[model samples]
Target: MAYPQELINEVLDYLDSGHSVREAERRFGVGHESAARWRRLRDGNLRANRPHPVKYPQDTVRLALGLAYGGHGFGLDEVAVMVGVSAPTISNWKRRYVEGGHMDIPEIDLGEIKHLSPDGRARMTDEELEEYIHKLELKAAVLEGTVKVLKAEGIDDLSNDEKAAIVDALPAGFTVTEALPEVGLSSSSYYYCKAKPERPDRYGRARAAIREEFALVGGKRGYRYIRQRLREREDPIVVSGKTVRRLMAEEGCRVSYAKKRRSYSSYAGEISAAPDNLVARDFHAEAPNEKWLTDITQFSIPAGKVYLSPVIDCFDGMPVAWSIGESPNAELANSMLEEACGQLADGEHPVCHSDRGCHYRWPGWIGICAERGIVRSMSRKGCSPDNSACEGFFGRLKNEFFYDRDWEGVTTEDFIGQLEQYMRYYRDERIKESLGWMSPMQYRKSLGLAA
Candidate 1:
């Protein structure tokens, strides 16, 4: 027997026009219960001949109900302010009207409410979801591998996303097996692919063993030399040249090489008669006046051809006396020797040694050494090793200092200063293992000699 608000209003209006309740009910299609309520309202209004009191303003009630229907979830305080009513009054009205199931009489139309369809709620297909999951897993794996490689290479700042991108860009079939040696990773991880007997179970352990041996021998031997030594002792394991090279590079191994040059004069006559071990003792003395070793070496300095006649002391290894001029004549050599002798201490008679250079063999230098009471020692002709100490020093000086230097910005004076500084550092600081692993100065101090 329920009736819509429209039907009730229609029956009530009909009754106001003096129609009976039964007639109004029949015309408006209202049930008996609804007709009874309309009859009561009509009779009461007729007796008073006055309009019925409005329950709420049409616009206010419509707005309140519209907000509720729109799912705004506004509280009574908020709704009351918008509808121009007290919060308590709105609360009571909401309880009496809405909670009590009173019919809503909306005066104006509210826009349509939107609800999602099944298709809209479920956008992604099973296939698409599976593809996304697969991509995520692949990306995660790629990032993990990239991080491993980067860490091995000592590059720690790479971002996770960048690492993932790098992993993705790797060759399609690339694996950690390919990266092992290049990135210096553990060998066990790499062995899963090749599983060759040649592959060492632990690369780091093998490398450590090789390095310890290399350190013990003082790097005087190359990889082949060390390998031969190891083989002679019946060590079954074999290492490749490339692996040794990489290890040597990592360990900062020192290497020596003779400068390459086209053959000029073989000095066959002098080589045939050259004596051995005539100049084995290394000499250095304190102050400029002490023990002197004189030698002549050729140079192509920018100022035409020049011969350097340097008289170095055997004590502190300082070039106390030097002369640079056009030709290495006996006069030039004698003059340098005389200059070094003049600077010597009182009663100090140093032994002057040299190869059979034409200047040293001449009577001028010979007479000077004899008059100065200096013991003259000569190496047999063409035997560079007979003057090994001086030759080795010159070779190192040229290769490590002079040969590598840029002469473009240097004047003669600048060159001299630079050479002086180099000699100072070489004597006082640079450690020479050949000199019992101490600097020349340190060696002198160890022997209780003044440096």
Candidate 2:
């Protein structure tokens, strides 16, 4: 948006009247660049009669062209001010003059005779006209090459802000409209994309809440779990899980952990006699405590391995009792059996099943079972299927709790605490499809089996 000659004169008048350049620019609503150009032109003793930087009328456009070649030491802006137009417009008029050797001033006749000089080249020599034509042709070729290069650069793939920046960085005389087509963007789309995206205040508030809750939960829970827990609050807020996920994506929030695997071993050689495979893979139980499964599984952390021995009632997948220690020994198994015996009321006698590992076959383990009036059952040697129920418990426990965690920072005591917490959460919070979407405690409660 070029200012008019009147404004430029006003700017110049202010400077000549001893006003600062900045003050002159502020008064004329022009920038420092325009003021500096005015100063330079004035210093060069150059003045245009009435040049406008924006547009030129009919006769003015032709007069601008003629003055450019008239050889009165007229620069483009000097020639432009003679009829109130820009240097680029003066240049465009020059392009027409040399290329066509005639003024095809259709839109700019202004009731004037049409010629570079009066009477159609009456005042100009043939050689001078020819030379001007040759120079104009060379300039036109360069301009065309520049435009072609710009078009071939494929700036269309750039982002809108990037394209806008490039357009802004163009030479002073060029407009963004000229560069828009080269970048294969419409003027409307460029302007629209350059504007900032508006988001609602609720959106900001919701994102804050999501971040707070996500951070509060240790950031390990996925979006689904986050959404579920949010709904479970005392003052529940209804929000879609999909919305939660979208907000998570916007915040760059992710579940803190990925799944990894671990392996453990049990002492398998029979230091004592191995029991018969009494349960024989008949894992189904018609009532609580009818059949029980026990196993000693190991968890390895950076601190070292911590062992867990648990008694699970096959009837409900319920962990009746469990013991954890730094070592998986006969004491671990016996302590767990003692807890299980305490879980039984006056009449309940469960057939305890296990793999043929030394922990289960140890004299301490067998003596406890005998004293508790519990039948002892074992898998065949190195055959896991015979104790598939017990093995299945280990698989489920590892898959659900142990496999996906980072235990590198955990000590044996801390790992034991976390393992116990997971067991409690599994019993009271985690749901199973086979249990009709209820946790073990919930299912027992539903069946009137617990106080």
Report per-prediction Cα RMSD to one decimal: 38.5, 22.4
TM-score of candidate 1 relative to the true fold: 0.39
As for model 1, its CA RMSD to the true structure in angstroms is 38.5
Tens digit of per-residue lDDT, candidate 1, span 56-119:
5544555666554446665666666655557666555556666667746243332221111234
lDDT (tens digit, per residue) of candidate 2 on 1-451: 7778887787887776545566565666778777878877978956566433322344555566556665545577765554445787677666665555766533334224223334554644687667556544543443454555457665534565555555555555556665665444568878876664553446675677778887775565577666665656676645656677888888977864433343655756768877677787889899999999887877777899889888888888999899999987778888889988998888788899887778877778878888888998877777778877766767766655676567887788988898999888877877665687678899999999987
Best by the TM-score measure: 2
Specify the poorest-scoring 10-residue window by lDDT in model 2. 105-114
The CA root-mean-square deviation of candidate 2, after full C-alpha superposition on the true structure, stands at 22.4
Q: Indicate the residue-level lDDT of 124 in model 1.
A: 55
